[model samples]
Target: MKILVPLKRVADPDNANKVKVNAGKIETTGLEWKPNPFDEYAVETALRLTENGANPKARLGEVVVVTFGPKETESTLRQALATGADKAIRIDATDDQLDGDVVARALKALVEKEKPDVVLAGKQAVDGDSNQVGQLLAEYLGWPQATFAGSIKSEDDKSLLVGREVDGGTINVRVGLPAVVSVDLRIVAPTSVSSKHSPAHKYPEGVRFAALMAIMAAKKKPLTEMKLADLVSDAALKITYTGFELPPARKAGIKVASVPELVEKLKSEAKVL
Candidate 1:
């Protein structure tokens, strides 16, 4: 089974306080770049699905990682390679040149070319927080989709049983092969992904770290580069960011001595009552 995992580079979520807006665009200066947390989970899920057994050294199939960003984004792809992805493909495009729709279109084109059995992506990118690409891509490809997947099990070579998180409880659904799975946080858990080869084996919690040898090995792995326009000639962004303004500063909290006082404050000052 061939799995395609789409990744994105984002400002270090840990340093979100350092992010700033300038001239209507996000300023990257003084910020660190890292793979989107959810995308890392997607990569981990793909790796787990393709793993041979509890043995970390055995791989049953290929995991191909792809991304859309500028030259610097190669670092992100390299990281995925270090995590045991067989190959890396970088789509040359600037941050401003692409949006959710354009990315979905570009991925659709790639899917047609690569013909992977499964496409796994994060439920959303933290930077934009617009959870639209996976659904849009599934629509473009006319394939079944499982979104916000918390757990995934390969029922066979041709189907998957996906556990999805809903408002009240989790719902399980079966999807055929050649489908799209957008993963959520729980998908990174030890037993989140299972297959015939390793049905009962458990992976370590969180994304696996690459050993020094794997890091060096990734340097020799195939890394293909392509222009975004070459893949989707008429790609156009359907949304525009006019400007950005920081949210209002939070106000300090006040203490109420009793329930009646709290109700009085809610009615008089907070005005929620």
Candidate 2:
């Protein structure tokens, strides 16, 4: 199985408190960059699917990571490579040139060229939170898709059994090969990705840390660069960022001396009752 995973770089989610709104856009200066958390789960899913149990260093198939961004984004791809992806591809494009639709179109082009058996990506990127690219890419390719997959297993060489997260409970479905899957948080669980060599084998929860050796080896891994314009043209963005504003701050809470006073405050000042 040749699996393709899309990686994205986003401002560190942990430092969300530091993010600020500027005149009409988000101010990201001095903020750290890291792979989208959900996308990291996608990468871990792909790596687990291709891992060979008999030999830790050997893989049954390839896991290729792709991303669309400027030169700096290559660091993100390198991180995925360090985690065991076979190779990396960076689509040269600026942040201004990319939106959900443009990204979907570019990925569609890569899908056609690579002919991967499966395309796994995050359910959404934290930065935009659009949650549209994977479905759009599947539509653009005329391929089946399973979104918000919590658990996944190869039903056979040509199909996958996916456990999807819904409102009330999980729904299991079988999707054919050459499909697209957008993963959610549970996908990073130890036993989420089934292994062919050992059906019961479990990976450690969360994305694996790249060892010093692996980090050094990643430098030797093949990373191919492609021009976004060459792959897909007419990528006119369908949406534009008009402006940004911080949500209204919360008011301070008041303390009440007793239940009656609290009820009076609720019915009068608060007016809830």
Candidate 3:
């Protein structure tokens, strides 16, 4: 089966965060970029599904990785490729514009063109903490969606058995071919640098092109783009920023010599147990 996985670029978790004022709006800056942690889980899930000769009933075909971000995001795809993705496609665009709706629309276009049997994405992106894109893309394609999937298995050669982690327990659901699955961290662990599989090299020139041309060329590689005008539900989501405030600075706490003094301070001034 042809599998499609959408990856995301997010702020490196180890870096300190800062807000930049762009036209009176707060924009995140001063941070290094890394693949969203959840997407790594999704990718690992996909890889695990095909590994160990698990899908022997029907030979697993290929894993295609897709991502939407600035040109630098290709590095994230390279990481995925090293991790075992058969090939990679990147939609070169400004990192800020990759919202739920825009990314869903773009992915819908790509899915229509590629016609993959399964599409996988992270439960949410860490940078925006928005979990809407996978569901939105599934809605756009009129495909069944399973979110926060804990485990995915092939029911037969034609259907997918998906396990979703719910509040109290897990729910088992099945979807026919050509469905979307968003994975939670419980699905799998992040792929390390060494476990990556090397992909066969394709034409370098077509692979490395300018941003504008790269997007144009992405259309040729099993991608289709649709405007909100063409969607039925127009259910694509938008994030609105209203205001921003800096967190209040914290004051240093005084050290106490004994447990009694700490208890007294907490009871009198701090008002804690």
TM-score of each: 0.93, 0.93, 0.71
List, residue by residue over 147-203, the lDDT tens digit for candidate 1.
999999997658999999989999999999999999999998888889987798777
Best by TM-score: 2
Candidate 2 C-alpha lDDT tens digits along 1-273: 899999999999998777799997999899899999999999888877887644557877889999998899999999999989999999999999998999999999998999899999999998888899999999999999999999999765478899999899999999998999999999988788785754677677788889999999999999999999977879798999899878888898988899999999999998999
lDDT of each: 0.90, 0.89, 0.68
After TM-score superposition, the amount by which residue 145's alpha carbon in candidate 1 deviates from its true location, in angstroms, is 0.6
Clashing pairs in 3: 82-196, 109-224, 110-224
Cα-lDDT of candidate 2: 0.89
Could you tally the backbone clashes for each prediction? 0, 0, 3
The better-scoring model by TM-score among 1 and 3 is 1
Residues 1-273 of candidate 3 have per-residue lDDT tens digits of 678899888777655356445665555666678888888877766665554432322324677898876667777786766655667877766644546887888788888877888898999988568799899999989999988887666654377777798899999898887899998766652221011121221111111113554444433443222333333234443765666655566897788999999999999999987
What lDDT does candidate 3 reach at residue 141? 92
**Which of 1 and 3 is the better model by lDDT?**
1
Cα distance off (Å), candidate 2, residue 205: 1.7
The TM-score-based order of candidates, best leading, equals: 2, 1, 3
Location of the lowest summed lDDT over 10 successive residues in candidate 2: 51-60
What's the distance in Å from true for residue 198, model 1? 0.7
* 255: Cα error in model 1, Å: 7.0
